[model samples]
Target chain A: MAARILIAEDEPYIVESLRFLLGREGHSVESVNDGAAVQARLETYKPDLLILDIMLPEMTGFEVLRRVRESEITKALPVLVLSAKGQESDQQRMADLAANDFVMKPFSNRDLINRVTALLPAKTLAGSGQAPAAVEAPMSSDRE
Target chain B: MAEISTGQRIRELRQHRGIAQSLLAEQVDISPSYLNLIEKDKRKIGGALLHRLAQRLEVSPAQLSGVEDASLVRDLVDIARVLSFDGLDEAIAGRLVAQAPDWGQAMVTLFQRYKDASETATALSDRLSQDPQLRELSHAVLTQISSIRSFAEILKDVPDLPQDERAHFSGIIASQADRLGLSAREMIALLEGNPGDEIERSQAASAVHEVEDLVNAQRNHLPHFETAADDLRRRILAAHGEGSITAAMLAHLETKHDVEVRQVEGDAFEGLVEEGVHLVDLAAPRTATRFDIARRLMAMELREEIEELARNDRLSGEDARQVARRAFANYAAGALLFPYVPFLEAAEHYRYDMDRLAQRFDGSFEQIAHRLTTLRRPGAEGIPFAYLRSDPAGNISKPYSLPGLRMPRLGGACPLWAVYAAFAEPHKTVAQFAAMPTGERFLFVARRVAKGAQAAGAAPAAYSIMLACEASYANRLVYGDPFTGGREATVTPVGFTCRTCSRQNCGQRAQAGILQRA
Candidate 1:
């Protein structure tokens, strides 16, 4: 069974890449650019898993998680948080909010796919054995 | 249910391992009574004793600390599962633990308890549907139980737990539960009922097991998750459209990388400006920022070195002042090559490796730190990288950047910054965490390399240079291996801020300055 995945990230490139990756893995993917749209999207789209980023425009990813956990309708929905802020405190806070999983930024496409596959409903994760995911070369940038 | 104290755990572990108290004491080289006191929770275990206990128990010192337990293990697994995308390894985790043990343990415990409680609550809620109040009470009780356990462990050293303190702890726990919408009375009642509730108990057991799985996943996954996240953030920033990255963006990246950047501003030079040599006055017109003037002045000093090399004669007093002016011009040129803002961005992007930054801008290491300081261009300034140069005997020769640090007006340098240690290490990089007398801690990396030397028989025969910046800014420099342990050994206590420093024992006091400086 294909898992319905929702991506809440402000970065277009990241969202696009993640969409392409999960789509290839045969999971249904929906995305929003900010935290404000999460509840509305959940109301209609009903994603089985959510991939969220910390630094969003209006409500933060943390705030979104709080609201999701608070509402009876979406309280049990599995959430996977994504963040550029990788402090120990940040990871702990995400866990405190009951996020199903977390992945840091600058992720490998294969690993991202693997983590998503593993965290999805067990029926969706069935075929993926615990073998090492394939590595992808990082894109070059002039900033560094 | 009764909870085991640290003392009880120690006694149990000792008994289970079949080791007698006296023998264990001998292994740790401590008196048996001292070991007894620790096991009884009569005394707190210090770092050395904790290390010995870990060695004996075949566990990490963190495990011996009694702050975290089985639930902590589960949280670690959960975090690792989320972070597995980054390709982080055990080595990185080891380094993180070594650098900050207490924080690591706290995180592990908090995550584990959260997962366990949530799962237990869910199952109990389903089982006690006929008794909503009991269901709510059960959840609250479990939450409070975990909170009280953790709090007791943290405050075990407080000997006597007063009623008010216990109430305060319970209040905090209740508030947290209320915020989470969990009810206490309901949870306790669910636990109080008949033996048939065992089915629900099994469900709760499964929740605990699931939490353990999550913890294991986190322990294995977090490093990779963090690394991947960092890589993604960098990619996002690199492809950032329209505008240059802002300070907030940089701060975001810094937080992601778990590194800090320290910025140092140039100090006020009292006598030099008034001496009528007019170096400050001449440079003021050409420069817009204080850092620009400071760099120009430093460059002028270097130019005098070049002139003395060419002239092959000692500069007369008037001629030396003239050389200072020329050195200022050299500084202006260096500043032009590596302007503050863009350079700092580049520095962060490259992890502050000097050679890499030098190649990027075609500038030198000294020039990079020097230009980095000048990044104090009002609104768009960079991190303050205080620049200091000292001779073999620890005499302060140049205090170009972070004048507020008050780098000795004459002879005030701390031995702990690795600035002096650089002499022994030569080209090798030495990094240290230094605490000033006033308890302001700074990370510093330093090296010893000579600038243009005086001729064979000048008034100053040998001049070696020592370069250092605050450790916070060292992420941009390539000199030291920062990830290694022994941070405690490397921490040297120092004080140079005249107004703020409180080294009452020092004989080289020019004047006492401010409190809480740095």
Candidate 2:
């Protein structure tokens, strides 16, 4: 499956990693640095999955998510809250704001890809996973 | 944090694992030249190629990208802020992060202990230097000892040592010993650091925190004070006040409330005392006199309510209670001078032009700026602003702030903040769009408020006041009118303070962030 993803983050280095990982995974990706810009572009990009960081300029990721949940169009948009603030309270706030997933900072690339892959709709999976999926599918069936 | 070159990281990882370059390169399916290029930072590697190398090297991609060991950089930054590392500057710290991360962590740990020890010593010394007469007595004893030494030298040089002269010298030596031993009992008590200023500093710090909590809990508004100020204004207007606050309002207080306002210089009398009212330096410029008058009025008229608020708030210490009382009086003064509802309306209408608003209200720029922070009235709310005041000497006087915004607590704020710069241009305001280290942008503005008049003998007290809000709120502010929505062009970067701020590129940073270690 292939999906258009938008990463709302400020750190250039982290942005590069996400871009490379998602691009290699065959997902179309775009990014915005500031919090307000995230909301502005969410509708315009209409990304299937939104990866957002909490600490952003102009506004915060929480503020962006609040707007996303309130808007008619972006209400059901699959949003993942990424933050350096990894406390339970922070996660709860993100969950309360209706984020689909939460990713902690200094995240493992493998863990991040897996989470992103899981969050996106199955129909959006890239063709590269098809052969592996087919093999795994038969194996699971045989076990059953 | 400065990034460690990919080559250096690879080399460190390889050496640590005892793997040869050619063996590693062949295993990763890269030419030895390519490996060398990556090692020397002559080649940029990312995505597939970087991951391929990471797999063969048995390291995470984050290790290659300077992400996994980023905390080491942060630790180095922190250590640098606290203590000096002559051989380990930022670049060297980055190298250490890539090559020897455990060493960096050790440095951070050691520095933390060292800093704690230093602060304890400072506090001890501060507490010991308290007694006055002890210093005078110590100096007298030292002088007496020096005189005795001189007399002994003269007696040694004299060829005809007379018996009477020897007796005289002996008598002087005896007196010297007597003087030295006389203050010996008193000197024992002066053997420790002075805690006087330390206690006062702690009290001031705690008091500010207490008030901040109170302000934050109330959503930055005081409705009762607002209502009371409004009532006072209506009463004054009903009385047909005709002049500045000192003339009309003071007269009204004197005639109606039987409260006389008197100016007394060289005295600590502020707010109100038993003799009706006694204010120190009543003729100061801008709104100091007006504020003094307003504070006195609030102290007299609303003493019961202020006391009740303080009592109910449950502040334990006398210092905190005194600070809270003064805070309430000042709040009432600001509210009385600039009534909330109209001020908010004017703020909105003028886009929060502090000077214009100050002129309109007959107050100082600092007054209007401070008053702006208090407009948290629920239905008629003003812009959420973080206000701060720092004197020319870099001492922060007012540090009222919200959650995202923190006023610098240790080693002063970043020198880059407009508030510090305002001292260079007295009575002038500087407007800017600043970004915090966290990438949160602010509509920052600062102005130097010169108190007192231009008299030959009077040296006016001068300090700078600064106010800021989130950049998105800039459209609602005239200060940010020029920059508008985009802040890229005029973004002056700053951080909270040296020890804690994580900004890597800030030139004014005295110390590194906690994560940036040696």
Candidate 3:
């Protein structure tokens, strides 16, 4: 599936790898290096999904999530929270803030790809089984 | 209620009256040797002999039985244990406290102040050497690890990547590893007690810690306070009828105690008592108003009982005892307002919900939280919960720990705990399952509560209150329901303090763990 994805991360090489991997997978990706730039970039980029790093500089991923959830235009955007903390409390906190999915850093590339595919709008990705009900309905119920 | 040793009190009264030991023993119809043994605490003296001794001493038997000089004797005994002399023993220490209390008290106070000052000096030195520098080094190391992990994974996975990208990734990894090595060396330097890090040791005494020691020694449960509170509650309900506890307290104060309760505006103090006129700030919250009234009533009604409870060996001096008096009064007021039996029943029925209990008992959130710690009433006790209160700056003001859950004594607690998170969203309760480095798991619920009445333009006094119990007991609490008795709870790794915790990989650790340093 090809979708507009926004990556909010502080690490440059990590961003480069993400951009390379996602662009090769046919997704159009835009990136912001800090949390403070994410909101403005989200408004301009209007991406279908946001990959957020929890420890972004200037502002935190938590503050960004709070603001995104509060904004009417971006409230329903699917979010994949990334963190290095690797604690269950962090995962639960992300879930509580309505993030679509949470992935600890040092995550598997294959798993990240699958989760991002699952979180993208169903119309943009056919045969994806895990399109959450709050997002658009799955076009085809092909369980993987 | 034998607050004092009858033998000790007897000896003191006899000495005060200037009665010779042989004459007193003859009047009391006991052998002089037997009286001497009793006065030395070698033998018990009570019943008819005690009454006779009091009669000869020209004091009531209650006075002889109620002095709490046993605590003094215990202090003297402790002093003797630490500073042993040729002829000193437990008997001589008891005799010292009984015969010359002023000298005994002065020695005990002096010894205790010395110990406290030494401990404070040690703790201050530890903080100065380790706290800030450790935090900075740990952050640098953790950040380096995060970057190194990501880049290393990228390098390993992307074999077909361009040459320049691979070399750039390799260069980043090497530099981060260098930074990590540097941080490790700095950590070693910190642990080895690097010089030029001395802190002022002038502030030695803390009456708060003394009271905390006393409370912790008793496991935060005082049966005497509970009984006094119950008696006061019953009397007020009987005299003033059953409406609200605050109303009943007001009526009881006005009718029985002859106290004039008045609401005053723009008072600097929240509550003040002078000339039998009780002034309560009109701007104070209703709960504060009721709490002040209840505290005043308890202080008035149970003064002697509270005093007896305060006469503990744990208290170092008058300041500690004075602090303990106020704390005891507040405790008695909580007991009076909640009335243990009914409160415990409600707590069980409501699944230990703080909000529900506060609503049912007409108390504030902090009051309900405080009452939760006092439920250690033997067989019918509630879950053993530790209580902690902290301000925004992470200064722990009130800390009560259960057996397995240790509260940090000298420094800030681990930043990852839910108690700190509660500060971000005031009044919103945050529940979490946290596991200590010792592998002990706890279910914690914390919320930021308003401290007291807010003045118009004041910065608003607020602090976070937390109640935590072993994860096994989480099933009994409403806040722990989502974790389903803590069986399936997702656990967050935590520590008592970063300096002592053994978990080396914790991203939030401020200092190298003791084991890590070693």
Candidate 4:
């Protein structure tokens, strides 16, 4: 469906695999490692889905999620958090923080693709906020 | 060289087999007396007998000849130095080897667990302290993660993302995974036991200690300085020493010594000498203020002698200058309060109780401890004492140890010391019979001082001051009451530093040092 996905992660290999799988599934991918940069990228890239890693420079994923949920522009942004810590308290905190989906790292490509597709389908990429109305309809039908 | 001896190993295995020594000697084709002699280390057995004995004992000759569990005993000694007063001596070792050998092994195993735990604790205490390897790995992980994500995004978002570009992205992920793995391994290995190169030296402390040594080298006594200090003491007492040595004493200083004393505003120093007028911090404690004036008066009276004594000191030019400036001044300040003879008599009377002595002299615990270390009067010497100061984060600021037991110049000290535990209970004096790795026991005492808040919103300054004297003199100290029973008395074992410690299984050990395997 050619969905635009923004991945916020620090580990490059996980991001690479996720990007490849998402690209194959017909989604456009943009990634920023700095958690603080997520908001700016959200307004500019306007990705349909945000894949966030828990540990990041300057700001952490949990901090980014709190801000995203509060801000008007990124309030409805579906965020899939990635973490290597995998502590129960961390998971519970993410859940309490209202992350849409959380995947523990070393995540498989299949797991990432599935969560990503559920958050932003190929067709919804246009409506996910940047593409024009004229292009949205054709991209939706082009998926079949 | 071997941690365990072949004879000890044979004794252990034979004891485990539960066979009579006579029967075992018959099987090994050696006389019972000869076997007994070999077991007791009175006879040397060559490789031929070593193999035959190994065969009879159903154990490998390597297990017998190699530095086996004897290394375990060395570690046990190291660990015991932290936990108790005694160790597995020759008699006990012989019994443990011949009767219940597992006891020794069990102790060794227990020590290893302790070593591991101590390491974990000290590492956590030093969390904010930087580890270069950790920082590097963290950076690498962040970079690799970013690269992997970026390359994958390129392959995903860009349509007809060239097949070559796709291949490149795949290769990066593969390469980065290896990089990440390497980074992870290094960080993990560091955590497992490596004490990396982050231990820093405090130049300020060494400079101060250099001055301390200059004073100490003279047996911490200055007869000429003492004579001059005595005269000043008599004069001050005759004039104003009947009352507390207060800031008001400046009137006498200006008239008698022709020195002007003035109060100032600043945190740069407790007091400073400016153009012969003594500018002291008005906000400082009254006791400290009095000490400063004493120093200034002493300096003015004994300038030539102080310079000559400092010049005679065996220190570098800069260090000698520092000593010349501080040693006499600090000595006068302290001597004015404690006054050697009375301080020593009071210390003996009070059993070196810093609190009681401090109250008697109207001084701080630190002031008392500092004075306690300097009681080396020729014929009537007090217990030879050493002092150590550290914070909860494992930073040792100032340390003094008796000759032959130089505490590690860097790091907080053995985590197992009661001084560390004293931090958990501030303002309380905690005592322990602590042994060095050499098994030389000492009566150790530590008290945590909460220096009160700097500002209303800020937390108070915290520190642990530990003092100790050789256990041989333990009877003279009331702190040694617990170990009065005999040589069988137990004591807490500790190391100079983790890196220098041979105790292998100390749970509190933060790093695996050269003595790691032992």
Candidate 5:
């Protein structure tokens, strides 16, 4: 489905790849390096899905997710946390923070696309009928 | 619990029954002086004498021996040690427990709380400060891998990528690989225990904790040292003009006390006194040199006073006493450099601008920061500020906090503190309003200060010093100028440490709070 996504990651290389990949998936992408800017951009950019990084400066993705869930306007904003801290406790904490999905660092390209597509608002998916082939392309080959 | 002699127990029972010492001795068929010695635990009693004493006191022989109260006394003494209740030996513990078992049980519950809180703090400190190298290395490696993986997948999946784009992604992957290799090597080195011996570090930490407890017990103020420092400062100002206090101190040391001052190249000891020569680090800043000289002067002029203060009853053992001696000397030096009334007046006048006070007093950033903590004079006090200094790696030293604000005794503080943030912007003051779980808010001011002169390529030795005072007193400091309204949202909720803090749903929480129910 075509949607707007915000990538709240610090690494330029990761952001660049995500921008390119998500752009190809027919999603408009905006990126910020730190957590505070994520909150600031959420109001203006208003991305359908937020890709959060856990180790962001100023605030962690966990804190951003918490505030996102608390505010009335952005309470239901779908969040997909991309993190290097992939411990069981972190996963539980992200779940408690109401993150829609979690993709660990050194992630497979196909897996990330699938999660992103799945986390986008169901209304967008219903309107668009189905996601792009890039979303499912890695699913079959990722098994190999 | 303390062990009580059977004779002592008999005497206590007799006293409880309102029997005179001579009457009890006569009833027990012993001389009064002999009974006195026995009551003092100097003489032993058993067999027929023990039975007779027990009968006269209306108790059994075993009760007279205090065998039933042995465990209670042990627990009381243990509790006393944990609470830092000075001089609570087994003898006193026995007396307290024997006299009132209900009060003894109350003490046991109090000790339980103290034990739980201390355990949580110690566990959190160990988790955060211990093996920091490993945590850093692992995070670095993972970050590098994430970058590498994204770029590599882009290269592999996007066969139709442009030439320049492909080259950029490839270059990034190569560099990230290099960094990953370096991180892996560092992690291996850390696993091999190359950093330091754990046992030695923990032993030193306990001694440091003892000294901190002693200082904290005294409210971080010593009037005796303050008086001597004031007198010495007057003598220095009178004998040698304030134009050069260091030179004047040197003259004072040399002429009055036959001591020689020498400065050697490179950073070493701040001031190492061997024989009659005082070797000061040549690379040390003027502030440190002057402070060291002042401390040396204090040691020379008031050695007896310093020694007496170091013998504080609160200090546990000789090691803690030795640490206290150095701490007391440093406190004396801070008082000498920044005399109580003048420093407090300047601090109030300047609204506690540390840099301005540093310039006014010719003190370093750290010297000024520490001096600010010693402003607890009755009826003439500045803001009561808690002081903490953390290295880049997050190990905190010389942590002092007010009553409501708890400071970690052994290791690093919570990662959410501005002290950690201060490292990101070296030399720039970072201030924040942090609220603890206890609903206490503090305005914390932090800045990274260089420790000593850096040798080329050797990692710069620096630490961030943070001073925190109650938020209510924020209006008195320049750092709190912008946040005078005390906006609730602007206050960042923080914790003492992860294990001890009971804040719920905190994203940065490292461990479940000990207070939380399963």
Candidate 6:
């Protein structure tokens, strides 16, 4: 039930960190570096939730959101906007576009996990529950 | 709710102290009519009057104003109720009372009312009376209402005319009132007159229309450049995320571009150039002055703070000022490096190719991008542009624009802008069609770039920068071609007027301005 999540981010460090954390949470993750590939990848992979960075190459997150909202096929898909642009107007704009949620970059790992976890379907949660349990058990064992 | 007004309190206090009205007026140094109005709640007591009243009344100003007393109103209410039962009202009719408590007859009526209401009523009354927080809240609410009423009264002085004309006048007043959160009825009440004749109505309508039109024009006159500048900014920021603008980067940009940048010092003013100056030339004089003032001010403000730090033996005053001067010099250097005129012409000539422009100016991609916005010289102007530079983490380092543009006061730039996208692609130019909250569209170019750190050995910081122009000028840029996809590229809507941006659909907007609303 773990849903596939796509992360469109330009920063390598951020992408790597997000991949590591989301991977630990047990969702199938596909990461891309720029906005150029977003539409094509969405058509093929059809990610259940798109984690999009506001600043992207070739296209901006806004343009991507606009296109996503415009397209009949993926118009209903939930998108969680991730951005380094931490402005009230920016957040307000994202909210107006019907984005499921937004998280600023340089974000807390826990916050990211909470947001990603909240967006996944119940089935996906159920599927990923076992993986996180396994992962937590190892860390707890190490403490012991 | 019917507690004594500040003026009444002053009067009451004066009488209690056995002071004459004229003497109190003298002490307060205000006209008797003004004092009378204050007591009747027709006017508010100014701070100066309050201070003098306190001095004359032998009480703290806060106590006289009832700002410090919670039970003063309840005490008056109780006194009034007791005095009512004792026929104290008749006593007042019979003799002019000249002191507090000497009017014990009035207190009798107040006390009787309190007794008749019973203990439960008394407890409720006590709760309302003794609660300092509630007293403060009530006072604040009353003060705010009084101010609103004052505004209404001021509006009343507007000349009266025909019925239709009055309505037209009312409409304009209503719009202004609406901005101030006042209702149409309230505004009409404030004006206190009706429009009468048809001609007057037409005039009023025209006046309102003119005002609205002026506001609209100002809102719409935001200057914007082509998408190439945005693309250039993105490339620079992507390369140097969240770092200081450095000399090395400036050098690198200069070496790459053929553009000449010369640094000049001093406060001397020279006569204007006889020949018509280019947009860049117009900007140069002011830019120097602005840079000098900013530098001087920053140094003055930081000198003491830096000196204090140095006292802890951390750094010397000289060291601190040196750093400040360096930072200032760097900023000034950036301004000079991107001299507005030549860059604007170059941008126009090259159709805003960032790489080509960079090469032409011998500037780093980011430096050129940042400079694109300073083209706002009034008569001989370049595209009035707003520029923002942010680090990789999205902390805005610099944001500036021409007069009409409204950049966000805090937080970050609009996420809808293409500048953020450029951070992902370091060298490549990114184009975006962005709309402001007001639904105005513009083509933007953004890119990522790097700048060297302070010391020679330190690693350079990577940041993202964005140069944006209005969509009206997009036809002059080559960057729009990609978005066109063989067809003419649809002009992307954007705006610099934060208050009126109508792009309600934007997720990056923190607050939709007045015009952005449906």
Q: Mind giving the per-residue lDDT tens digits that candidate 5 earns over B108-176?
A: 543333333223223333332355555445546566776765675575467699999887887887676
The TM-scores of all predictions, comma-separated, are: 0.27, 0.49, 0.50, 0.46, 0.50, 0.29
Candidate 4 chain B lowest-lDDT run of ten: B197-206
Off by over 4 Å in 2: A1-144, B1-205, B240-248, B264-274, B280-282, B312-314, B452-455, B485-487
lDDT of 1 by residue, B1-518 (tens): 11445567678889999999999999989999998998888998745677678678765453466333433332343344332312233344444454554545554544444444554555555444555455335433443443433443323223365778655654554444344334432343346546446434433432333332222222211222223333433453565542332332334334444323232222333534432132223222122233343343334334444343324222223333344344434444454345444676887777666667767765545565555555543235455555666677766544543322334322345554467777787766566666677555555656665443232442432223444455555444554455334466656666644443566665555554433232
- Fraction of true contacts retained by every candidate, in order, equals 0.00, 0.00, 0.02, 0.07, 0.63, 0.00
DockQ, all candidates in order: 0.01, 0.00, 0.03, 0.08, 0.25, 0.01
Q: Candidates sorted by lDDT, descending order?
A: 5, 3, 2, 4, 1, 6
Report the number of the highest-DockQ candidate.
5
Q: List residue ranges in candidate 6 displaced over 4 A.
A: A1-144, B1-341, B402-405, B453-459, B483-518
Tens-digit lDDT track for model 3 on B1-518?
22346677777778888989999888878899999999888998666686677667866454576433454555454444333222345576666566666666555554444444333323434343346555444434444555555554565466597999888876876666556555544544565454223211221245676787677656688777888789878877887877778889999898878997888884644555577788887888888889999999999998898898789776756767888999999998999999999999999999999999999888999999899989987567888889999888987877887655766544578899999999998858999998888888899999998765577775668789999999988888888777773454377888877755788778887776554544
Q: What TM-score quantifies how close candidate 2 is to the native fold?
A: 0.49
- lDDT (Cα, tens digit) per residue for candidate 5, span A101-132: 77876576788999887877665656663431
Candidate 4: where are CA atoms >4 Å away? A1-144, B1-206, B239-243, B247-249, B258-279, B312-314, B317-320, B450-460, B486-490
Question: Which of the two candidates, 1 or 3, achieves a greater lDDT against the reference?
Answer: 3
- How many steric clashes does model 5 contain? 4
Q: Report the backbone clash tally of model 4.
A: 42
Error of 1 at B293 (Å): 19
Superposed by TM-score, candidate 3 places the C-alpha of residue A81 at a distance from the truth, in angstroms, of 53
Q: Which 10 residues in a row give candidate 1 chain B its minimum summed lDDT? A: B215-224
Write one digit per residue (lDDT tens) for candidate 3, span A1-144: 468889998767567667866886788899998999999998888888899987777998889988988888888888888754323444566666778776665455566788988898876566443332236422221221
Better of 4 and 5 by lDDT: 5
CA lDDT of each prediction against the hidden true structure: 0.52, 0.67, 0.72, 0.64, 0.73, 0.50
